[model samples]
Target: MLAELIRRDVDDIVDEWEQFARSSIPAAEDLSPEDLRDHARLLLLAVAADLETVQGEAEQHEKSRGELPDNSPQITATAHEHAQHRFEQRFTLDQMLSEVRALRASVLRRWVEQNDRYDPDAVAELIRYGEAMDQALTESVAFFGAKVDQSRGLLLGVLGHDIRTPLGAVRMSAQLLERTKGLDERQSKAVQRILSSSDSMRSMVDELLDFTQTSLGMRLPISRVPSDLGSVCAEVLAELEALHPERDISLACEGDLSGQWDAGRVGQMLSNLVSNAIQHGNELPVTVTARAGAGDVSIAVHNKGRPVRPQSLATLFEPLAQAKDMGGDRHSGSSGLGLGLYIARQIAVAHGGSLEVVSSEQDGTTFTARLRR
Candidate 1:
């Protein structure tokens, strides 16, 4: 009965809904009347048609849970298209939801006005109508959120990539300055500072690129080739030593550390692990060890310092966990996006490996990464 009522007064209902949308949303000021009315009418017709379909108790439950397949393709398509249009017009999520609320209210008010009093059948039809409208709303919200995420991911990816070119030039120039003849101690120190800052910027930009790629449903890219884990670990340790001349760190390797893996990515993972250790290890010695198993190799970086909080252990490898978990003194002198450990774990997973950590007062903290050959 409600479905027939909607069909009979669809035009009037759509006109009122469009007017409400135009008034509530500033973005709608630029939209033509026809554009605002088109999807609302189609969505209303789809909901009315769906209300006429017979459904059992089980189906009703599934519909209420939104587990049922959208039986009306038009409802889904129209909602998706409407959401896209709103997103392109720079409409906020709240504004889009307000339009749905306005449409539902207009239809319900018309139906109630036509019916003199409440009846059992009318109440049941109203519930079914609400479920239909809810489904449409869910679809629209999902589409709009996805579009926002995709756009943000793309913007970060492009910005990060474009920044690398200029950043690389600055780093190279600083390196050249460090080698320039007849430079005083202060001048040399300034150049070294520039080089160090550039390295930090490069690391941040790399993390941003990697984070965007993974957030946008893309896997961390890796190129597997014949490599030596021992060599990679030694190279990473050497670089860390150059960067932190004040710190004491050492590396040890046992068994054959040869494997089929992405050498550069593995080096990056080790670098992140060791850097994390040096930063939080309270000026104590940091140890790096590598050992080969039957078909895999494990690399561990151990640090002697205050133990990581028990509650923070679970999220240690999560992006931005550093900012959330590490505060005050622990976060001092640390300038990163907190993506280092997260990206390290992703690299391990991409190489068909795993990464884990253990921390305690007596034993300190150790992060171990195992990679399959």
Candidate 2:
């Protein structure tokens, strides 16, 4: 049978597999032979054993769908282990997959050479072997992708933290320069630019840190104290007005705006919404409204401009979703890594609230955050 043949020639197949993997992948160049051959023998034996299992028509269908019982634990465990080791070795995902591909080719070539007679059993065995390889590849790829995401989150966390110290120093220096006496007009303008640029960089760093926290499956931390929604909206609007002097931004508040909430996070959410409106609102006036419902508080930022595309509405708040400048008077300084809305939504969610948007050509676009008190 094919299983016995695999068991007998596994070593020979692995030798060819190792050679091909080493030659094809640059990262494998520095790895020792033992590392290169890691888990190969076990993977091959697991596949051979899986081929020998008695799978009925139903099980075969489930296997094809990747929903069948894991007949061999070794395949799954070895795939994860191998992928983890390769990731630590600095091998790229493609490079690691190339090794798997080489092993598949080596084994298939040897099997084909031995089985010149094309019969039904031979065809079925070949199909099963391909399925096994595919299963292993899927496991390894998933594990590798998870590792990559974790590393990226860690790097972003470190970068965001490390950059803040220098950014703070620059901002402090600019503030000191602004207070200096007898400054010329050009010098004053330059200092203002420095402070503005520093604020922008600080905003981006905060967004990156928030993105890292959310992507790592952690909710945004909030400290709820006795805070007024009206005060929060006013403070955020004042800051935004200073940053965007040319934009006409107004705030309207009514009905008990006092609540127990994180005022700072709410301000952050409002700032993101207002900035997005100003950038995409086609140089139009933006309005902020806060209303107190029976048990909830709703804050909406409205702007008149081109409506967001219907398709994009679903993913508008997803991190890194391309905020395409869709032929409008988008602010020149509005470019970002597309994490503003995502972080805003996360903040709202953390406060046991939700953020939503409604856009239409005639009615304009409005983003609303409803927080439960």
Candidate 3:
């Protein structure tokens, strides 16, 4: 899936480059050799860089999967070397100028042949096509720029929002500590609880900021070391146990469980799932299970809660789309950004995996994350 996604993205890049190149060539009968050489050199350089980045990422993935053939890297390197060699050996600035002049001459001949009896309607249609193409290219550039700006704005906004809650708690706790100088044991314990909750809120805010950054297209600098899925699960369960003592949480690992993954990301994904289960799974016992196969590992979190309606399931992973309130009183406390599941799914996809949900009135809801080994 990751490879396919990367390939599609690369194809889109190539298509955009081709369209830009086609549109950039001037429609004059005469051209300078220097200009042609400059254009071709720049275009070739951009294409080479893009191809190199895509191939490098693919090689890294193949290396992670232990499936990199011995000749693959050599072939990639050779292709790049050949492109560089051609860029240097095949055409000098003067040669490019000559080529461009020849191309201009050819275009002029074709234009004269087609210009003798051109209908007014055909001329107008061609003008309209050019205008539309220009408009489309302008809009595409602006749209991408706006998306990048919006992503940055969202990252800053979320960071500020995440920080405010914990800072407020810390300030409130400090005031209470100063005022309750001669308080009873219960009052002191209450103050301590406030301090503890403040600390937890701070940690959660950090995680939220990190998760937001990752979701907003920040690449994970992952190291390909052998990792134990069971150990990651156990650590996540232990952390969740501390956070939610009122609920019984269990981790079940079946068979030989080992894989290569970013342990921190895996833990974060699990933490998000378990946290969601606690928040929306009611007060029932939540169980997390993990199973590893030849080339994949699956982790599932099950909670005994009301089933989700079929209509709500479709948009569950969409931003700001929450599961409908199963009952009037249920999920009353889940009033936030509604980004947990969305972030979890992003993390899963980033890991070349996916998160899926299954629910019914008979059994309860289960969210499963499957990562490739």
Candidate 4:
């Protein structure tokens, strides 16, 4: 049913395009080859727009349904059919039009190319018309694409907000349960586990909500005041130690490491990086280092682990990329929505800084966050 509605929408757009093309380019009996070619290019643009709208609508409908549509396989088949139709119908028209335009351009350019007896006024008029048509088509395509992106972002933001509300309430209730009295040791352990699980779910929900907001160009509200990078590192290290008392973690400071940044964001970034390193890195000691300079400050969290693969390196900052299998370790129990590095990078960018990764088999991996002066 939704597919039919989308298909109808595509048809409507196509009809609108046809009307636009007919009005823009009249079908005169004595039309020049260049005019015909321009009409054909406009037609092609309309067809491309129709295809994009159809595809986008189908994808969105699928998402809304929370499952693939019943007609999805049929739709895929129809898309192949449409591709073949393009070659048969639209491609031929485009090629014929292109050839006509090229021939006309070549004939007219001969006068200018030879610098001979031909008048220049007519050639200038042809060039001007061609440039105008090109600009109009380019602008139209860009405008439509931007509209589609904005629509998608708004939908995702709404969905993220709805999902987070319930998750937040569940987390609060779980914490309340943990504080109840008269529980035996075994029951206490179970309650603690529930609290931990709730915390993890809440974190995942927050990350998704943040990503949605960022997708819509929303910036994090971070206040920049004098903050100690060393202090931030120490706080994050302390939290991690409390969480994982079995792990040997150390914090090292090379200088006073004072800087200007949002204290909360800085702390969040460090906590994410350090937690990731400890979870994925080898059992050897993990180190958090801070260095201050005249114009900038740098913080790095290093861990001993297997080198990250080259292909996965580019996508490291993308959410959900490592939440499932960190370096192929299934036992890690890190089933997150994959927003840690993504959020860290966003915060760094917001602070006019950057985050980077360096890894080697022998030395392990180091993730650094640098804030400029």
Tell me the deviation in Å of residue 82 in model 1: 1.4
How many pairs collide in each candidate, listed in order?
0, 0, 1, 3
Candidate number of the best lDDT: 2
**Residue-wise C-alpha lDDT for candidate 2, range 1-373, written one tens digit per residue:** 7788889998888888888877788888888988888588888898998999887888777888899647557788889999999999999999888888888888887887888698998888888988888889999999999999999999999999999999999999999999999999999999999988887788888889999999999999999999999999998999889878998999999899888899999999999899889888888999999999998899999999899989888889989874574446545344456888999999999989999999998999999999987
TM-score of 1: 0.92
**Candidate 3, position 160, lDDT:** 57
The Cα RMSD in angstroms, rounded to one decimal, for candidate 4 relative to the true structure is 15.7
**Who is ahead in TM-score, 1 or 4?**
1
> Candidate 1's C-alpha lDDT?
0.87
Clashes of 3: 1
Q: Which stretches of candidate 2 lie over 4 Å from their true place?
A: 69-71, 325-335
Q: After superposition, how far is residue 77 of candidate 1 from its true place, in Å?
A: 2.1
* Candidate 1 residue lDDT tens string, 314-356: 7888776663544324332244667889899999999889999
What are the RMSD figures for all models against the true structure?
Answer: 2.3, 1.6, 14.9, 15.7
Better of 2 and 4 by lDDT: 2
Q: State, as a TM-score between 0 and 1, how close model 3 is to the true structure.
A: 0.53
TM-score of each: 0.92, 0.96, 0.53, 0.59
In candidate 4, stretches whose alpha carbon ends up further than 4 angstroms from where it belongs are 1-149, 319-337
For model 3, what is the alpha-carbon lDDT of residue 315? 89
Rank candidates by TM-score, best first.
2, 1, 4, 3
Query: Which candidate achieves the best TM-score against the true structure?
Result: 2
